[model samples]
Target: MIEYQTSSFSQDEIRQAAQIQIQELPQGFLSSLGEKPLALIFEHVATSQFGVMVIAKESSNNRVIGYVFGATDTGQLYKDFLIRRTFQAIRYFLPKLLSWDRITKAIETLFYPARKQQKRQDQEECKAELLDLAVVQDYHGKGIAQHLFGEFVEQLREKGVGCFDIPTTAGLDRAHRFYEKMGAIKVGSVIVHEDRPTYIYRYIIQTRKHG
Candidate 1:
């Protein structure tokens, strides 16, 4: 059996989640920052008021097997991370800035929300977003991801979010399929990092109206 709940941001649990993130998303930019820095990012998110991190654990062992984390306002999340984790962010990201390619990508990431707003002016802008979701390889096909996603969605709902967006690498067919299966509509695509295409999907939360 597996249990899922919002994370308390414990050091050990953050370490486990970071390990899973690096293992499952080796090519992601955050994973390139090394495990310790990645763990710091997880801790930051788990503690942020605008963010939510849900973890899945084995019932008997209480070992983290999966996690899904995102923010109620992605723009604010990034801004807050930069402001609150300034020293650590500089310590870790400063080294990566030495590479021209990485610098360009970082700039693009920093301005992504503004660019997205310009590109999708006709559509409703969704401030809320589902940033990352990952499950241990051994736990795949066990419905852990679904449970984690459900919990994250519930968190957003409780926060009164009407809709949210999910951006994933273009080639991740399994993830795309899962989002589609969960009723997320494909919105469009964008290039956030040079040479990498990302697909965007939006999900609307159906809230019942009280009579």
Candidate 2:
């Protein structure tokens, strides 16, 4: 049996689970968020308003087997995160910025801030996004991901969210199929980095009509 609950796991435990389950970081906006810092970021997101962080544990031994992180308003959460964790972000990013490639990329991004405007604009109607979801390999085919996602959607809807924006890499057929199975529609695609393209999907919640 498995139990689901709001994230009460420590940063290290969450990071370790992520390390095992999430093999690749989506390249583009999330390319810079490395493994070590990702855990810290999750910590922040878990506590933000409209934030959803849930963990699943194996009842037999009380071990975390899967987790999901989502937000009703990713844009606002990030803004607040920056404001609240200014020094922390600096502490984490300063060393990475030391590399010549990192410095060059930062400079280029600063000058080309308008490139991602379309993607940003699309978020105007998207009320939520599944920022991250992962389940341990050993637990595959056990319906854990399905349960976690179902709960996530339910929680977001309770918060008045009607639409969700989900992005996955172009080559991820299995993932694309999974979201489609869950009622997501292919909305659009955008190039995140220089050449990497990501497909954006939308899932709209149908509201009951009152006579």
Clashes per model (N, Cα, C within 3 A): 0, 0
Q: Where is the poorest 10-residue window by lDDT in model 1?
A: 1-10
Kindly list the per-residue Cα lDDT of model 2 for residues 45-80, writing each as its tens digit.
777785788888877986778888877876667667
Question: What local lDDT does model 1 show for residue 66?
Answer: 92
Off by over 4 Å in 2: 7-9, 21-35, 100-124, 208-211
What TM-scores do the predictions have? Answer: 0.94, 0.80
Which tens-of-lDDT digit does each residue in 48-167 have in candidate 1? 988889999877977999999999988898899988999998887788678887788778988887777777888889989899999999888988888888998889998899999998
RMSD of each: 1.5, 3.8
Give the RMSD in angstroms, all C-alphas superposed, for model 1: 1.5
- The lowest-lDDT stretch of 10 consecutive residues in candidate 2 is 108-117
Q: What's the CA error at residue 185 for candidate 2, in Å? A: 0.9
What's the CA error at residue 166 for candidate 2, in Å? 0.2
